[model samples]
Target chain A: MLFGLLETGFVYFYWGNLLMILLGGGLIFLGIAKKMEPLLLIPIGFGIILVNLPLGGLMDYRYELTAQRSGVVQEIVIDETTRFAEGTAIVRTNAEILQSPVHGRLTSIEVQPGQNVGAGDVVAVIITTMQTDQSVIPTEPIGLLSRLFAYGIMWHILPPLIFLSLGALTNFAPMLANPRVMLLGAATQFGVYFAFFISLFFGFSFEEAASIGIIGGAEGPTTIFVTATLAPHIIGATAVACYSYMAMVPLILPPVINLLTTKKERQIYMKPKLRPVSKLEKILFPIVGAIIVILLVPSSAPLIGCFMVGNLFRECGVVDRLAETAQTSFVDILTIFITLTIGGTMAAENFITVSTLSILVIGVISFASAAAAGVLFAKFMNLFLKEKINPMIGAAGVSAVPMAARVVHVMGQKENKKNYLLMHAMGPNVAAAIGAAIAGGVFVGVLG
Target chain B: MSKEIATPMAGKVVSILVNEGDTIQEDDEILLLEAMKMETTVYATDGGKVKKINIKSGDRIEEDDIVMILE
Candidate 1:
């Protein structure tokens, strides 16, 4: 049988599937045993397990085919014997209009000459795109995950909704208090471009490189948004890397922060109470921020707009109910759907490849570099400031949110108990989320 | 004179460590608040006797919401 040809999933269960399952199990173990991002990891791991069970057809897909009108089979490929290329007239009824659905051998002609066919009949035996070989393409669409992914992910619905929930959960007061940290967040995007060029040097196409580079953002929804548009083949790998690495920010960030700073710098006390952001400022932030970003990168309107809207709900105070739902139950439901769907896409065929390995390696490089860049830039900014900001807070300038900020806060406490950087680190931590969305928009504008 | 202890941010009141009429000192743990999915201990800023509890366990409190009145 041809490789990738649909068959009993168990028959094709090879080392690839086993390996992916092990990786999924490892993710689940890390989430539970190590208490690392258990909220997202458990669902993702279970999804990987569900799809890799060799339970045939979990990821199958096909093109839709339907006859438009009822009529008699007037002729069959006029001058041909049995086969025709796509767009070639293969079925002709009275008025004559039917193109061959696929560019390969016809499995069979559904109708004979003078045979009556009904409108809305399943007369079109169209096969989906030739994934491996044209010979194995399915004649009809199959599987549930493919459709959900197509509409929810590729169609760009769920990513923005997920972003909205994230926005609702975000508290922009810290970022607005120390607006300068926005610079540190922007600096981290360097990691994206760094990995982009590195990916090209390693021979990935522009689209694929763009998708892979976004893993540096350490924001899973944004990575998914950009990847589904630019290069879908690598979404699975990039997403897995994005989330797995996000969970490991504690592991990856501390080392980079340590490598670049002196122990004295870590011990520097940062004020816990940030400048109180007024309600008006909080409300205006989402509006003005969304306008500026949408104007700059119109392509990213969906993500930025949704994010700002969610934040607006939170800041407005009038929509406490909406904000409440957006951050809580709404986010939980979306996480289940989005993460499980992501895991479903991580089929062994697509994931167990050289590209996945490259993405994982490049992801770490970009992640570490992003953290280093943040710390370094903060140190640079200190040269000009009267009251110096602790540089370790700069390491929180990734979109990992409370986790990244928490890591920085914990590290600060380790160095000096009096130092409370949670509220301060939050500035760059939240800014990094906006920074990533903005950078992702720019990339999508230029490359997508 | 009575001083009010407010939460630093919005979160669910995880547990109340001090009861009304209890004497507490500065920097004492007043209660636990869960925010951003992380639990943080809310501390007393000034030593005082708890006069009244304005919030109970499991109530969602916003930033600067008075959780307790310390006398």
Candidate 2:
């Protein structure tokens, strides 16, 4: 019997693996053909394909050692210098194992081939191997994607870097011009709590429920950050849901906005003029904003703090080189790694479950509820204010950035050609970024 | 008093939209400034005739640096 031939991955392949490969190709098609978030979708789609290939071992950790025998009383060799007594049990920490020499020096032998050791008992001791530089010299082969993910994401480094890049690219002029529009931003977070409760009703723990609720915020990095902390198992589904919804903002938000606001309200024209934000205000925004938000939600400091630092680099006008790197090169590189890891996390075994379907459905509901809440809140505010705010601008408060704001502008244009709502819509659009970050922080603070 | 049209941020002057001595209204774009891949139109704060153009296209201007003089 040729055992090696029978042990090939082809014998282990199943229908679910084929389905995941097709789904990955479909995402790639959507990214390339539909022009939807190509930067994220393409890498994630390819990662999905890479991880789903049976025997590819892209997601497996290669350094783990398993017992090869069920007996005792065999000779034990420990490197070139030492030999351990038979039946001597040995234990090593994960760090120690990873740092060991490439060939994995045997530390001891607890059982020999004929010693009749039971299952799950220690049979031998081998120190897992690594090179001094830690790049896994050719002797030991670690899964490439798994290594990147473990070091980059598991250590909690990538999400904040993404936020830093976002902050560098963002312009705060619109948000600063009309601070009150932030109320709409805050109001949009109603769906976060609403979805949290709904998720709880569906039998999710408090931590998982909080993570699911953050999908309504429509901010990808924030979603990843919260999930990575509270419910890491669901980060793949939640991040995909968040980014897909964000890309579909133009399609998803309009119907909800139209359903909630009448033509009269949508036609309410907002002046295009925005007060010029002062240099001092721009410089103070990140500093003061970080202090206030962090003081309120310390758990959010990592994401918010990095964001403010990047923004300060931009607005300070002294660090143009640093800001440029953060916005362009740094962001682009980190995005590729993060999206790839997010995709890799969705192995067929983990992704095709009923829980993923439930997450997808709940995510859409959360998004719709968020859009509705924003429009309804704007209408509520109009009753008190002498100057009526166009309710459509409220729909921009979901933190999809320019897309949500652009949708509002387009809807306003449909009602009145003379209406220019882009600038006014931007006020809430930028505020939603801050609002989503704060909501994520609140969830982590309460749940974590 | 001649009002100096100052740019609010440091950037390269991409284009001078108005010629020297061109009559301009308050908030009328005087020139386009490019920074961080974004184009910000520097607007005249006071309605006046352009008396002296202190900076031209392709000039690098600092915050509060005079790009044009309005009288």
Give the top-scoring candidate (DockQ).
1
In candidate 1, how many Å is residue A26 off?
2.5
Segments in model 2 whose C-alpha atoms lie over 4 Å from true places = A1-8, A62-142, B1-71
User: Candidate 2, clashing residue pairs?
Assistant: A71-A112, A71-A115, A72-A111, A72-A112, A72-A115
Candidate 1 on A350-411: residue-level lDDT in tens?
67777789999998888888888899999999999988999998888877877888888778
Scored against the true structure, residue B14 in model 2 reaches a CA lDDT of 97
If chain B of candidate 1 is superposed on the true chain B, what is its TM-score?
Answer: 0.95
* Model 1 chain A weakest lDDT span, ten residues long: A128-137
Q: Rate residue A397 of model 2 by lDDT.
A: 93
Candidate 1: give the clashing pairs.
Answer: none
Candidate 2 vs. true structure, TM-score: 0.75
Grade the docking of candidate 1: incorrect
The prediction achieving the highest lDDT against the true structure is 1
Evaluate model 2 with DockQ and give the value.
0.05
Every model's DockQ: 0.15, 0.05
User: lDDT (CA) for every model shown?
Assistant: 0.79, 0.77
